[model samples]
Target: MRIRKKRSLLNQAAGGDGLRRVVRKAYGVFRREGLAGIKTRIAWLRAGAPGTVDPRRYGEWVRCFDQIDDATRAVIRERVANFENPPRISVVMPVYNPNPQWLAQAIESIRAQLYPHWELCIADDVSTDPAIRPLLDRHASADARIKVAFREKNGHISAASNTALGLATGAWVALFDHDDVLPEHALYCVADAIQRNPEIRMIYSDEDKIDESGKRREPYFKCDWNPDLFLSQNMFSHLGVFQKDLLDEVGGFREGYEGSQDYDLALRCAERAGGGAIHHIPRVLYHWRVHAESTASGTDAKPYAVVAGERALNDHLDRTGIRGTAEFELNGYRVRYALPDPAPLVSLIIPTRNEPELVRECIKSIVDKTTYRNFEIIVVDSGSGDPATLGSIASLEHDEVVRVLRDDRPFNFSAWCNSAIEASNGDIVGLIDNGIEVITPGWLSEMVSIALQPGVGAVGAKVLYPNDTVQHAGFALGLLGMAGRVHHHLPRGSFGYFGRASLRCTVSAVSAACMIVRKSVYRDTAGLNEKDTSMAFSDVDFCIRVREAGYRNVWTPYAELYHHESATRRDDSDLAMQARFDKEVQYMRTRWGSLLRDDPFYSPNLTFDEENFGLAWPPRVGALV
Candidate 1:
């Protein structure tokens, strides 16, 4: 009996050892192949275990592996060697009085870049620090790439950057702040991108936030580069890489935009580049150091930053000949516009099939909430099975405020919207989905404010779920497949992974759910594509065309709405809907390849599951509910 018990104990020990081996091997596979590999491992283990391993426990194990794998990959990329024959890049960094050690560290990080063919052009704007000169000289002596240029008189950052720009001889110019660090592969990655896409005059990459200790805190902006968005917000962090010629063409950076000089330069470049050809490398290549002295760190510290951003925005408007006003204040913050008049007789167009209740709510919201009173609600019905819908419309007391148009051809969202717009009388047109409910009282005023901005041709409202979580903040090209879903529900007011507002962004496309467009722009873009007769990406197609016509498409958070997201129409056949969605996606991919592929607003980090259904149960309840 004792011998048998000893053998049993020995067998148990062996089994434990075997389990460790399996776990280690599983982790190894996960590290190499990511989540997919861990899933495969879970299946393999389950197949062997049968009732021994609980499916729930196995899933937990897989999750562990995935986290480990992601961390491993991040570490590998952070340490990876860069390209061979690294192209020469001149980084123009401007410094005022920055932390001595932190500034030294920032310069040192540049020196540590894997790419050898790069120069650090440090332009000091008469820094108050007495110790700065010796430290700059010490680093310059250590590395040939480091060159220090100081202004005897204070010229501020804009002048300092230009001074460095004048010295840049490299093929590519990368703008950096004195407190920011270039990841080891920043120059190398830029060089690789330039070599790959010769036609691209500028390339911007993703960036991360680092604290004063130089420890990476979080990724600020993770989406791909978007030019239309570049107009409204400076999406490209760590500045960006510009072809020296292109930089010179735009006359370097504008002077008045002292805090947001880089933003001004990017907008000017986008205007010059026209559309397409600008590249956004999705990887996090730049590290923006956040300290007490960082402009974004304190409100008092960067009052000029906001002013500079506003100035840059105005400059883009002026340069592009975009008709709009700037510094127009509403609800405390300044809202810029191009239109002189507020009550321009906007025609609110509603395209619906059978949503009588929704139509009533939508029309009522327009009448009740809109600050600008000169507007007409025009409902274009495709075909409604419910006779009550027609009855409800007939029963409305204000017949003068409501007009109904009929289309019997087919259930095409785009076609219906176009028909409504055609029937409307106003030069300024607003399209709202039947399922949307306006939340803001001055929603129309806010939208028109942006729509009337000099360069803005199209404007979309910030759409929220009925539950109040974000539905569609903005639209981007190329998110059609992996994150092919539109109108993501994000955490309220949570600027996503990249300091990008979960609230506002400019994009190549926006949802027809709540879009405002000028009459001329609507006619100029030839209305929405009628060929896309089904419910898919017709809004995207229209916005792309509008952008092609030299107009900006903007998404404003000021105009808020609750979108019951396809609630008016139910897709009984999932298979058919998927097929139609796939076809439209393919169409977009083929026709607008560059925009779809390179748009910075397109975030790869957002997977299909995360974007469409949003974050899972429990945790999402507080924010989403």
Candidate 2:
């Protein structure tokens, strides 16, 4: 080993070719990943790759890819000149007592835009600071596009925003903060996306936080138009844009939700323009200034924002007629859906081979710990030779809620599940593995509430290993060319990556180990694929089919359960099993091409290396379009 190290140093030291190779490799990483990506590669060589990449270093990323050179300005100008009535965006900013330098920088960022079809409308909320009005007047005098409105009385954010909205004449309105900065190409990108997707009425982009020294950090590379996640947190806070008609339709923000005025406005607009009318640009367009008072520093800075956000979310739920209560937890909101008048009967189907102890624990936990009153257990045993296990199964039938199915057939998991569903007498069917045990008493309640929703297909839980580490949060497709668990191996109660693991967001698929689905929809979507995926990939395939049938599969971190997955897991070293696994992979690729490769809930900026929401080394997206 010592000689190899010595030879390596000597080879690089002998000629410039070796050093050139090192520089060339770094340059390649820059083209793929940004400037921080070079440091990521070095860290991997020094201490091995981290479980998740440190997604900071926003300054490096901006310099590497988001640089607006003269050539970029020329392109923007040429593109705008050729357009037919390219949108003139009206940026409305609500102001109070802000730092003078920061306010000047915010106004200057608007003046330096490459896309010239924009107007700035500023409304001052009776600031006590004397510097506010003079600075505003200087800017209004300098540029014909800048509009300033000084409020006579002290109104809050919502009222101030509406005052600024009254001065706007453009077709679209872009929400802005008094101290925040927009990139030179921000308006250009929004206009470009509008031109491409003419039906879209609302749009937002990724954002980051800038400190007093103008250093950027904490970049938030967000997903594409996630409605559930939008309820939890206001991802549309920065770079949030809307059509003037939609803004007017929502009545231009309510006065009560002062701190979370944007969130409330977004919810109302989302109700009007559902999923089909919104677009997301995967680029950092807005920079929120971080200081002692800004929420970007931490939520503790503004406790009122959290409370107002909850109120806004609860009001959104009521407006949509969803019978659910929203509560703030883990830095996001969790909605507890109410069960129907006659609580839907849940039939939990547990398939076992010959494991008696595991089966007994599973059944005992459901009977002892589960708080849900109306449910039954159906144990499907296939060819169990142990007489003692058979005797215990027969004895379990003495209880009215426990039913035993004696099916002495081949070990086909999919076939057993379908047969169990056929024999079950309930409105909802839960496909639970025999090795899983209940951790939370309200586990059944959470799953039933979500699965009982109209368009929701499969509802999964937060499963943990016996050691209290995460076993499965959900399924992320394109993980090593197949599906893998999201937030796998995270310690219990870990709020991963912008609190995604803690939020009930949409997923492409979920594990069958602990999932619940409505019986009517399950049968209509054609329950698991039994022929080609009898053993493996059946759950993912079933979920894909369900999504194709216009039903969304959901995964929640609220329902906690202990999954002894290793006990039921089998090694794939045998040639026959390996061949079958390869065939299933090929079948999935041929059947679902892009959908498997790209998950809507998962970002292209995140890596599939560990499926743990790490920043992709050279993200799938590039600079502004």
Please tell me which predicted candidate would have the highest TM-score against the true structure. Answer: 2
C-alpha lDDT (0 to 100) for residue 6 of candidate 2: 25
lDDT of 2 by residue, 532-555 (tens): 787788899999999899998888
For residue 582, what is the lDDT in candidate 2? 83
lDDT comparing candidate 1 with the true structure: 0.66
TM-score of 1: 0.71
Which portions of model 2 miss their true places by more than 4 Å? 1-59, 566-571
lDDT of each: 0.66, 0.82
Q: Model 2 scores what on Cα lDDT? A: 0.82
TM-score of each: 0.71, 0.89
